[model samples]
Each structure stands twice: as C-alpha cells, then as structure tokens.
Target: MQARKTIIRLFTTFLQFDSDKAIGWVTDGRLRRNIVNSQVYSSEIENSENFWVTYWYKQWQDNPKSLAKEHLLAYLQETCYWVASKTVKNIYSPQYTVSDCFQMMIARTDKVLKGFKPEMGFGLKNYGSAIFSSELKELLRQEQEIDICTNWRLLRKLTQKRLTESLENIGMNSKIIERYILAWKCYQMLYTPTQRTGTRKLQKPTLQTWEAIAELYNNQRLKQLPTNTPECSPEIIEKWMVASAKAVRAYFYPSHISLNVPHGNSEASRELIDDLPGDEEKSPISQIVIQEEKLAREVQQDRIKSVLLTALEELDEESRKIIQLYYGAELSQQQIAKKLEMKQYNISRRLSKSREVLLYKLAAYCKESLHISLNPPVLDYISTLMKEWLKLKFNPPTSEMEN
Candidate 1:
C-alpha cells in the first residue's frame, strides 16, 4: 500500500500534477469506463484494464507528447513494477537493483507501446511485459559480456563501427583510429579462446598469443597503413588493446532515457514515429512478404508441429527427458536437476541445447517448406512460433485435455 502511494506520488510530481487531482484522475470511474464502453464489447466492461489501455493508447497515437500518453504510462507503472520484480529475482545480478530494471523498462515505453496491437488478442500489459522481458534479457546478456570477459575478448567482440566510435570519442586522430582498428582486427584473428573456455568467461590471451597477434599486426601494417608507420611490438599491442577495451566499455554502458523529456521538435518527432512498423508505405516485396507470412501462419501451425516433433525425435534421451521435465512437468531448472541427479548448470545447458535444436529445425522448415527467407525478422517469428508450439504440445490447455 505504501509502495503504491510512493509511485503515485512520484508519478504526480513527474507529470507536474496537483496531488489531489492526480488521485482523482487516476480513480475516476467514468473516464475509464464510459470512454471505452462504446469501443469494447459489453462483456469486457467488468475488467476495464484493457478499456483504459485502448483509451489512452489511441490518444497516444494521436499525439505522443499528450497528457493522455503520460496518464497511460503512469497507470501501467504497476504492471511494469510487477515485471521488474520478477526479472530481478530471475536475473539476480548484483549490479542491477529492482529500481534499475524498472527504470530501464520504463525507458522502453515507446518500444513496448509500438509493439502492442489490440487486434492481436492480447492485453496491452501482457504484450508490454513480454517485450520488456525480452529487451531486458538481451540487455543483461550484453552486460554479462562486459562483466565477465577479459580485455582481449572485449576487443574481439567490438564491431568495427563501435571501435571507431570509441576511439573517436576519446579524441584519437583518424590515423590512430585506423591503426587501432587494424591492430584489433589482427588480435581477433589470432587470440582465440580454448574450447573449454565458456562463453561468459573468456580467458585472457597468453603471452605467446599476444606475441603472435603483434607479429600478425606487424606483417599487415604496411599493407593496411602508410609505410612510414612504426611496427608495433607485443607491449605496444597490449597497451592499445587495453585502451580500446576501456573506451568501448565506457561508450557502451547503459544509459536510461526519461519519458518526461520531449522527444524532439514536431517534425523530427513525426519522422521518428513514421519509422515505426506499419506507419510508412512499405514496398511491393514487403507487402507480399507480410501477406504471405500472415497466410502461412494461418495454415502452417500443424505443419510446424509435425516438423518440430520430428526434430525432437532427433534429440538424445537425456535431452528429451530434460525438455519433458522442464516443459511438460513445468519444473524449474534447479528442480529438474535435483530430480535427475544432474548438475544445475548441466540442466541449463541441455535446456538451451534443446531449444537450439528446435529453433534450427523450425528455421529449416520455414526456408525449405514454407519458402520464407531466413531474415532476422522471419527467424524471430519462427522462433516465437516454435516456442508457442512447444508450450502447447508439452502442456495443452486444461479444456483441451478434458475434451
């Protein structure tokens, strides 16, 4: 009760509203019910959450900076809080508190709202929670890379554009940036972690590895850079690599954006909103692809089931049991490990491996059978489709089981 009041108070202050008015507006029954009554079915009035969502969502679409949008986001703070609580428990990272995660989720309000569709048969909060979870998980995964990896691994993962930006951010000259990029490229090619090295904890390069990287950089420097440039020794290479890592780390640290600030001037805001999906006119190919995807979804559910079943059959007995226990029995990884007398980490890895198998099979089926191009969006679609199938297959609805 006290926590809710605190959030309400903060929301009021953040929006610069009178405390009494804020309370009244949030509690207003007529605004919640009457406005959406005509839009929703008669049956949905009893639970007016979706109605309120539809009400303010429409207003937000009409104007992103409107008070209606602010009110809508404020209303959904409880929903966002619920998600953040569960996320903190699951992720259990020392670096991120519940407040930190909640703020991050709030920062992504535009993205969450952009992905919601009333016609999709999901409530706004439900869809928003899923998006928030996925986005948060990806963010944490990136943070994990930064947290656990050595300088060499960090350098290896940095994209050319990122490395250039980091170097330029730190006031490095163009020529110096070019040299660092080439040196990092050579380092990436030579300093490979051993197979036993986990993805999360990449071992630092050995002296021999650094020497080899320096040798490679020396050999390639003249070809890539001016002949007058000095050849870099192992010590010089290590120093540059450390500097690059620090710069990349500083540049890529997460920064949360607040909702209170204006997005931009009207024209730029319009352009930003125009870039959202389904806002602008898509090309002919895009239209056909969208149509084909919709049609395929309607028809391909059963085909995907069969394809996934075949793929599951390919799994080893242990992997099969792990999937069954995790999905069918709906057990946590720790519980599954306890039951099977396996290590918890082993259980986690197997579960991931099982998903990878299913994902691969689903992608292949989409390409070979459905003839869908395996683009990122299409792959993501297939992955989601596969998960839905697995959930339904392993744990059918209670009504279906009874029937």
Candidate 2:
C-alpha cells in the first residue's frame, strides 16, 4: 500500500513538469539508453497490465529525474501511424497518402500528449489512439469538404465565363453582368432537374434565395467602390432577372440587331479597346524600378541563405543529419527513423528542435554579424525560405525541371 501511494505521488510529479522539458530530460542519449537497457523496466513494459502507467511510475520512483520520453514517443508513433493508415484508406483522395496522414497525426499528438491523464486508469495506447483517430477523421473531412467547395466554385467560374462571353457578344452592359449572373445561378438552383424523376421542373425562386443573391451581389459591389453603396432590393433584382430573360430569349432568336456588326459601341467595346495592345516599350524610370526591385530580392535571398548555412554548421551532427535527411534529402520521418534506429516520433521531435535551434542561432548571427535584429515573423519567413531553397537544391527535378 505504501508502494502504491509512492507510485501515485510520483505520477502526479511527472504530470507537473512541462512536456517539452520533461521529454528533454529523457531525450539525453545516455539517459535514454539507460532506460531502454534496464532489464526490469523492459520486462515490466512488455508483460505488465497498464504498461506505460506502471513503467512511468516506476521510473519516477527509482529516480525522479529519469523520465523516459522515448518510450512515450515510440508508443505514440506506432499507434498514431496505425490509426492514420486506417483513416487514410477511408479518405478518397490519392493525395492524402500514408505519409501525409502520419505527419498530421504526429503534429496533433504533441498537443494531445500534454493533456494525457495517466491517473485516470486508462492506458496511453487507448487514449492516444482515440485522440489520433478523432483528429485524423476531422482533418480528412475538412479536406474533402474543401475539395468539394473548390470544385463547385471552379464549375461556377467556367459557366460564368461562357455566359459572360455570350452576354458581351450581344453587347450587354458590363455593370449589370454580375447581377445577371447571380440571378441566373439562383434560377438554376431553384429549377435544376430532380434526380429521381430525371425531369427539369420549373420552380419559383424563394424569397430567401433572392435575398441571398442580392446580398452576395451587394457585398461584391461594395468591395469595388471607395464609398458605401446601397444594397440591392428584391424588387430591383426581380426586374433585372426579367431583363436578363428577355435579352437571353432575344439572343437565341435570330434578329437584325443580333447581326448588327455585334454592336461594338457598348461597355463591351470599351473593354475590348482597353485590352488592345499599347506601346510595348516601358518607361525608363519604370524599367529601372523593376530591375532594382528584382536585384534587392535576389540580395535578400542570398543573405538568408548565407545566414542559414552558418547556423546549420553550428548545429550538432545529429541535428544537422535530421535537417539534411528531412529538408535536404526529402525523406519522411519514418524513413529517417529507420535509418537512425530511433522512434519515428523522436525523429519528428529532433527535426522540430533542430529547426528551432537553427532559427535562434540565425537570429543571434544576424544581430552580431549582420548588425540586424529580426523579429519572430521575419525569422520564421527566413527559415521557410531556407527550407524551400534546400528542397530546390537537393530534390530531383520533375519533367518541368528537365525541360
């Protein structure tokens, strides 16, 4: 009973420490090997009920400072990967590969682990798997929804493009083009063919649909004007729909007006006039400004590369390898884990830590050597730029690159 009390107390103490600092304590090479090499801990971990809870409690009791994050990370990696793989199969998109799923799982698991309660009498595997699966499903659902919306928008754009061309050919006014498009879309939504009957039905537009279309049009118009514009009324929208229907009917019927040299005298004519080629030569001042801006960007990129290279050199060999394998070699974390004989989650942690260290060192180098102090946002941008540069430099080119 005393041992049980001691174990509970130890578990509470482990929970008190910040996860990163606690993990860092066990991430030390010697400490990790010590924990892994322990015959008693190994035997208990494999055979015991509530393995992680019992193992962690034992570590805390034996040495309060000897918390092993590697064990926790290994369990997280295995469970997360399994859950991610299963989840990805359910997702229809080929783009959401096992690697992508695993990456997302690991990213979310970090935050989830911080909230883990070992004292709740559940093992980490069940708790962690539940969290992993929930997050993966949510992510996949969001991506699928986004894809559906994007495809719908693209189809709408194509329809609008063809409609716009037809309207312009008939010399329709530009100002009312969008209003006509919105009214037409509302009409289609209200009157599309019924799936079961496979027949087009004429349906009256609902007041709600008309109001929504007006609001959308008004919002779009408001963005273009410097001053506030009055919102369109439903009455005015109905009149516009009447006018659009008349114009569309006239468009289908052959008439002298339709053949009147395409009426090259309306707003559409002005648009065509604007699109006509002007002088090819740029003004000298504009040319010089463009050249100077390009040069400045090039110089900034070079400076960022130089600073990042210096920082990379300053990192320890292991951290450097993590960066190289990830950014430089483009290998996934699981692949790096196999190469290094470490847990996949450990590889993720190391890569993240290495990037943080590199950013810090880069900031320090800029302050001392370049006489410039970078804020967090700027440092983040520089780090992203450096990673992109490494990818471009190391990754094999696609067909576009070969061309």
Best by lDDT: 1
Steric clash count of candidate 1: 0
lDDT of each: 0.64, 0.50
lDDT tens readout by residue for model 1, 1-403: 2223332232222321121111122232222333334333333232334344554566577667654555456666655665565667665666666656766777778887776644333346545666776777876777767877777677767789989988888899999998899989988888777856556556678889889999999899889999998998998998999999888776555565333333666753532222222221111123333334444444565576677899999999999999988867768999999999999999999999899989998788767876668888656655654664565568653321000
Please give each candidate's TM-score: 0.47, 0.32
Q: What would the per-residue lDDT of candidate 2 be over residues 66-148, giving only the tens digit for each residue?
A: 33433344345445545655565644466666656656666565545554534322346555766676677776765454344
- Minimum summed lDDT over a 10-residue window in model 2 is located at 16-25
Task: Indicate which candidate wins on TM-score.
Answer: 1
Local error of candidate 2 at residue 147 (angstroms)? 4.4
In model 2, state the lDDT of residue 196. 36
Error of 2 at 153 (Å): 18
Shift in Å, residue 158, candidate 2: 25
RMSD of each: 11.1, 27.8
